[model samples]
Structure formats: structure tokens, C-alpha cells
Target: MTTSTTTPLQRWKTFFADRSSVVSGIITLVVVVLTLISYTGFLQAVERRSGVVFVDSIHRILGPIDVTWPTFVVLYASLILALGVLLTRPEHLFRTLRAYSILVGIRVICMALLPLDPPMTTIPLHDPFVALFTSSEHSTLTKDLFFSGHTATLALLALSMPTRSLRIVFILSTTALATFTVLQHVHYTVDVIVAPMAALLAFVLNRGFAAENQ
Candidate 1:
């Protein structure tokens, strides 16, 4: 009987192992982890400053937004997981992730530098949706203006898509979400407007970086 020899499949493994890809992946992961830690710390500091300790305040602001909470959670989780998977293949993931990392870092920095008081300070909630800003015992890390996480998160998801159609869909869907947040008085008008711009800034930064490297 003749022995059959199995050819080695080395090319597939080598596909994403280029120098740029590896460097970019490492940078992205470092940024993601560090930024998250910093973000949590920032929020904690905000809480400390505000002096409010009741968890109900958190729920009050969030309850109205919960109208689409499940959807947001699923979408956000998928985006993050997708990034992780892409990282496994650095060649495909590096540039994109790097760009996103920049966005995240930028947002955090902006928030830290300009912490805003949330609307809860002034609005009173007669109902779940109608709750205006209530006074918080503790201050938050960031102010209510300069950006909107919901909008930015939605926009980030949209911008992550390479195709135009998906981006447009994300923009539209997030717009609706933003509208709901405003109608419910969860966010100020400025916050909703700023979110999209922040996302756009990310897109431009990513493109510029990619071009510079190429």
C-alpha cells in the first residue's frame, strides 16, 4: 500500500501576519483595554464628585432609554465581539480597530476634559419618560453636552461597516433612538447632535491614518 502524504497548509495561517497588521492589532488591543479601564475610573470619579449614592437615579435616566435597550445591547455586543474575532486575523482587523481605538480614546479624553452635569439635575420625573433632570447627589465624569454615547455607539457601529448602505441604516436607526432620548427628556438636544459629529470625526481620522500608512 502506498502512503498518502498530506500537504502542509501554511499559507492560510500566514495570511494576516504581516508586520503592519501585527503592530496595528497590538496597538488596538492596548488602546481598547486601557481606555476601558480609564473610562470606568472616570465614571467612578464623577460619582464621587456628585455625592449622590442612590442607584435609583441611574435607573431613572436609563429607564426611558430602555425602550430600545435590548436592541442596543445586542448590537453593541455584536460589534465588540466582531472586533475581537477580526483581531484574530490582524491583516483584516488592524487598521479598522486602530481607527476605532482612536475614537474611543478621543471620546474619553473629551469627556474627562469637559465633564457635564446630566439633565437629571433639573428634570423631574412624573412618569418614566417624562422625568426631567433630577438632582444627583454625585456628579458624573462627563457633562450632558459635547457627545452622546448612545448616538456615538450607534454611529460607531454604522461607521464600522465598510459598505455605505449599512452605515446609512445605522445612522437612521440611531437617529430614531436619539429622537426617543430627546422626547423622553433623557438627553439634551446638544448631546444628540454631538454624537453623530463625534462618529464622523472617527471616520475621518481612520481614513487619514490608513492613507498615511499606505
Candidate 2:
């Protein structure tokens, strides 16, 4: 049988035929928006009330370590690639996205309660990245210190993925990124640990929500 062309609205309705698909998509978007709000608020609060004295103190101890630009770039690239690949299947996409959302939300909650400063600002490191991390205008978003956001995001992406290979890649990429964060003095040992913990907590919440909905 020949098919007649459908209008854009009709096509949209057909595409979202499953109520679950549409509802999940909306819920996912809501979760994302909430996380963004929490993140932005946490950063602003920290910038207004805190200083870099603690980070400066830590820098005195870690200033001797040297990290190259190329290494940091490679680590960042690997992290993006791993997360990109895992976020692709439609079947698990919403669930995975929600998990990521929860992870960021958790981090924001932690940061709001316990704002930690990066070593660069507190230590007054001379590195370009350090300056960026420490500057009030530039560092506002990056200075929230409950955990490494990138590391936790990478970890959540990996943990929520179903495939073993993807999980392995996620673990490897997150580890590399976390290592870079610590070595670069962008985050502390506690932040690295919290990244995985945040992901784990998100995963648990995601699973519970999914089951309840089912």
C-alpha cells in the first residue's frame, strides 16, 4: 500500500505514539532543568561567601607537581567520547539521562552544604588553568567543591550504561579524568572519591524511580 504524507504535527504525534516515551522525555527535561538550577545557585553562593585561603594552603603542598597541556586535552577528549557513545540508545536514553541529572543534583546539594575551593584559587597557582579556576568571573561555576562535576558526570554515564564494554570505557575515562583533576589541582582527593559516590547514588535513585514507574 502507498502511504500518504503526514503533516508535521501528525508526524510528531506518530513519533511519540507511546505515552511512556513522551512522559519520560518530559520528566527527563524537568530533571535536567532542576539540576541546572541547583548547579548555578550553588556556584553563585560559593563565589559570594567563600575565599581561596584553603586552596592556597593546599597549593603550598602540591605546587611541585607538573602536568602537561596535551595530557589534559587527551583525558578530556576520552571522557567526551565515552559519554557520547553511551548516551545513544533510545531504549535506555531517558533512564540514563535521568541518572546523570540526579548525579549533578546530588553534587549541587553537597556543594551548597559544603562549598569547597580549588587549590589553584586558594593556593594562588601561576598556571593558566589555575588562574581561570580562581578568578571570580571565570571560577564562579567551576569552584563548587563537593566533588568533581566532570568526573562524576563521566562516572554516572558509565554506571548507567548496560553494556560491559561501555561500562569499562566509562570507568577508564572517568578515572583518567579524575586523575587529571587531582594532578592539575583543580579538585581534591575528596572530590574524586565523591564523583563515583555521586554516580552510585544517582544510579540507585534512577533504578528506584524506574521501577516505581513501571
Candidate 3:
């Protein structure tokens, strides 16, 4: 037998070139770039506008107590971990990206059509990601809060994972994230509640594209 130096990832990649991961990957890249652009633009546009206030029931019930200890850090960490899992498999990552394009496109529309200020009691989430594109450190990017991106993103990954076990685990993470987002009052009750449906729709539409690509 020949000396085995090739890694397992190389074997997997070699087996699937015929399945058109190359095309899927290219589309995913394009979509990822576009999504980032649109997301940044949306945030900038929203930042320019005055926030419209809504009386959020969850914020009223929870009273924006500023629980930054475990709830805040743990929820943000879960989003990072969910993304890491999605990147573990090429096929899974590509399909999830395709779905994400749909999810993000819908989100952009929702944010544009439903532009509203954060709840008066909304806890500020000075996210590091938002800071990347912000014009100034003094400016707070808090107005782009129509639906919950964190909840929707984790929901998309949960719905689009390749394996049953991975999907189950991802869903659990999504549930945890949804709970924390609600409890933290970072998102309105309706915002987080409606996000998973949007994500599921995105995944359903992208499945057809994924099937055709493979």
C-alpha cells in the first residue's frame, strides 16, 4: 500500500468535487459578500434615522435589569459556537450560506419596511460586529432592531445542518439563544418570536438550490 499522508478532510474534498462544491462555494462567497454589504448599509441608514419607540411587553415585564454576567456573554458565545459548527463541513457550510442569503435578504426588507426605534427600555447591545462598520466609537448602532438577527441566524443553521444529530444540537443552541435574547430584552417579544419562521422559510427555499447544485 502507498504511504498514507493525505488527511481526512482532503479525502472528503476529493470525493465531492463531482458534486459541485466548487459552484456552491463560489455562490456562497458572493452571497456572503453581498449580505455583509447590505447589512452594513442597513445599519448605517438606520443609525441616521431617529428611533421610533414601542412599548415592549417583555421589557416591561423584565424591566431591563442589565444582566451582563452570564446571560449576555453566554448568549453571544453560543452564536459564535453555532457559526463554528456550520463551518466544520464544506457541504453544510455552503448550503447554510445559501440559506443565509435568503434569510438576510428578508431581514433587510423587514428592517427597511419596519424601521422602529429600540424599546425605550431596550438594553444596548454594543456588539463588536456592529462596531466593525460604525463610523465613530461615540455613535451607538442601536436602531436596526426590527427582527432578531441572532435568533434568526442560529435558527437558520439549526434548520440547514446536514446531519440529524447536528441539527438537533443546533436547535438546542437556537432555543437557548432565543431564551436569552428575550430575557435580556435586547429584542422585542415579537421580534424574536417571528425570527425563526423567517429563517425556516429561507432554509426551505435554499434547499431547492442546494439539491440542484449537488
Among these predictions, the greatest TM-score belongs to 3
- Per-candidate TM-score against the hidden true structure: 0.64, 0.73, 0.83
Clashes of 1: 18
Which 10 residues in a row give candidate 2 its minimum summed lDDT?
121-130
Better of 1 and 2 by TM-score: 2
- Name the 10 consecutive residues with the lowest summed lDDT in model 3: 1-10
| Residue pairs in clash, model 3 | 52-117
Go through the candidates in order and give each one's C-alpha lDDT.
0.56, 0.65, 0.73
Per-residue lDDT of candidate 3, residues 107-132 (tens digit): 88998888787776667766665577
Lowest lDDT block of 10, candidate 1: 1-10
Per TM-score, what order, best first? 3, 2, 1
Better of 2 and 3 by lDDT: 3
Candidates by lDDT, descending order: 3, 2, 1
lDDT by residue for model 1 (1-214), tens: 1111211233224544566655666777788778666665555565444322222343344444434454445445555655554444334455556656776666767666666655653332123211222224323222433466667767766767645675676667777767665554455566677777887788789889788878
**Residue 48 lDDT in candidate 1:** 45
User: What is residue 5's positional error in candidate 1, in angstroms?
Assistant: 30
Estimate, for each residue in 22-89, the C-alpha lDDT of model 2 and write its tens digit: 88789787878777666555566676776442543444565434454634565557556755654444
